[model samples]
Target: MAECTEESTMCDPRHALLLQSVQSGLPLVHRPYAELGQRIGMSETEVIGLLSEWVAAGIIKRIGVVVRHRSLGYDANAMVVWDVPDGRIGDVGRRMSAFDFVTLCYRRPRQGDAWPYNLFCMIHGKDRANVLAQIELLAASCDLTDVPRDVLFSRRCFKQRGARYAARALAAS
Candidate 1:
């Protein structure tokens, strides 16, 4: 096994190749790594090591799947935004993130005039009403009654993929 240095972790050829392959999200078969390794001039173990190292170094934020909610019967998904005080945004975000039903929670730059929300969360459920109920519960739990909020349900999805940076890197290479 090659000793992975900090520099090697960032832009090594093997790591780059593994990143490109993972970003593509092609179906992983019985010998997925081995097949990928063959194309990238590495063995399966080497590919695994490169990925593991990248993860440890925070180069790879996550390895996961993106499911189409509508196809899976979870048709109702909403982007719930809150106009939380700057001081309490972190506390509110932490509380929101603690909920299993809250899939994504983060702070975003407030859009002037139309959008006043600074904190955002994503809630998914079987129906729009169910999703609203979940958001209501979340708001009550976070003592967010005084805060203004809006829920934006996605009407259409243009594109969804993992690791946009990885895709750009592959394109560059």
Candidate 2:
């Protein structure tokens, strides 16, 4: 068995082949992994096993759709950042995420006196008015109105893609 650390998780020819083939895309068929396996000369089970191992080894975070909200008719996307008391971040963040309008929520490091916001949430709606309304409602509902916060509505999307890591494997003859 080729354990993930056995040149399979990273810097392995086999792994590179798999990554390059799928970098463009996975097959659109029902059994995409199976299709990939067939193209890469591996059994479906083998493909699945390799993927599982890679994920466990942190070589892969996740494979899912990268939905373009604006293309999907959602014109309003606002990133709400909050500066809650240090002790309340976890509780406040979890509460903020409970709102149906809050699509994405996470925490980030705060820059002392400069930019104090640590918790962030993204709210998507049909339009700017709708998004602002949701944010107002969130403030009241989540009891964050008292908390220092700012809403940065997206002006335009510059880029959205998967992570690009520099090559670590030199081609082998």
What's the lDDT for all of these models?
0.80, 0.77
RMSD of 1: 4.2
For model 2, name the residue pairs that clash. Answer: none
| RMSD for each of the candidates | 4.2, 4.6
Q: Top TM-score: which candidate number?
A: 1
Off by over 4 Å in 2: 1-24, 29-31, 38-41, 52-65, 165-173
Q: What tens digits encode model 1's per-residue C-alpha lDDT throughout 77-105?
A: 89899999999999999999999989999
Off by over 4 Å in 1: 1-9, 61-65
TM-score of each: 0.84, 0.73
